[model samples]
Target: MRPTLFLICPVLLFLGLSYLLPFLGIVQLSFTDPQPGLAQYRHVLSDPLTLAVIWRTLRLCIIVTVVSVGCAYIITLLWVRGTPVIRLLTELCIMIPFWISVLSRAFGWLSLLSNRGLINTWLKDAGLIDASIQMTRNEFAVVVGMAHYLIPFAVFPLATAMRNVDERVLTAADGMGASRLRIFWQIFLPMTGNGIIGATLLVFVFSIGFYVTPALLGGGQSVLLAELIYLWIFQMPQWGMAAALSVVMMIAVGGILVALMRRNAETAK
Candidate 1:
């Protein structure tokens, strides 16, 4: 035990210096910079624009979480039940995005969704429409890019839960003449509920911090909390406000995690 403590203490000390110290600095900035007090927090909560941005961030978080998790559930089901080749292909599809940088993926979406891009060009040549549809630089485009980026995050947790399910129970249900839909609805879905919750939490938390995709695709029209924070720090040069927003976001995320943990504990009981 003494040796284990010695080993763990170094790692903990390293984290304290590298991560915790910096975080504490940010928290300090929120209160100390530009004449202290709760003024920064007050402004963040009271300002209409900040409130709107917060709401937009939350709304987009929910949209992206639902879209990513729903699609990931389908992919996870295939991965769990499919043949070796199909599983291999599914894995390749899921992992390919991880290899690409976030900036590249966002730009790729821009090229595909832009007016003169492939989809519009094809549509134009095919005489599908007279004018290009406004696809890029919108909420829809942001959601698409975010969901594409986050699907893999949703997939792994769901696959883990699905793989843990008892196969014999499914076989017994099938042998008992249960319809596919009924068995899935009654057994598989309930069994994977924990995974769904986990994926939702993971994706939603990630979605809140998204910057590049929303910045590029939103075109300033659909500004999220992260973008707003950036504006406060660099563009507006309001470091105090930015720090306050960061602290608020951290507290909100922490609160959500605590609430979910309590609920999960209650459910287990």
Candidate 2:
């Protein structure tokens, strides 16, 4: 025990200096900056624009979570059930995105989805429409970009759950004349419930904090909470408000994680 404590001391010390201290500083700034009171928190919670941004963030997060999880489920299903070559291709598709930077990925989506971008240009050449569709700088574009980024996050958890399913049970179900769709709906889906929930929550949490993709794709119209936080800190120079918003977001995320932990513990029991 003494040796274990000694071994972990450096890690704990590193975390305290790097993470915990900075977070505490932010919390302190939120409460004490400008004055030692809850004025910043109250203003953030009560302000109309802030409230709108909060709602937009939550709404977009839900949409992105659903879209990402749905696409990831299909991809994970293919990855788990496919042949070696197919699995290899799927893995490449998933991991290639990770190698690319987030900024690059957002720009790539912009190139494809912008008004005069490849998709619109191709559609025009094909004479599908006379005018280019307004795709970029909108909620749709933000959702597409966010979903693309989050799909990989959703896939790994689902793949783990899918891989753990007993193949013998599936074979037995097939032998008993259960249809593929029925078996998947009843057995496979239920077995992967935890993965689905985990992926949804993870994606939602990530979407809430997304800044760049939304900033680029949203064109200032679809501003979310993170963007609002940025605006407060840099543009408006309201450090206290920014810190308060940060604290709020931190609390929300921490609450979610705690709930997830409790749920996992219940499942373990």
Off by over 4 Å in 1: 1-6
Q: Quick one: how many clashes does candidate 1 have?
A: 0
List the candidate 2 regions with Cα displacement exceeding 4 Å: 1-6, 267-269
- Please name the candidate that would achieve the greatest lDDT relative to the true structure: 1
CA lDDT, every model vs. true structure: 0.93, 0.92
Taking the tens digit of each residue's C-alpha lDDT, what string does model 2 give over 42-143? 998999989889888888888999999999999999999999999999999899989988899899999999998999999999999999999988899999
Worst 10 residues of 1 by lDDT: 260-269
For all candidates, the clash counts are 0, 0
lDDT score, candidate 2: 0.92
lDDT of 1 at 6: 96
Model 1's lDDT to the true fold? Answer: 0.93
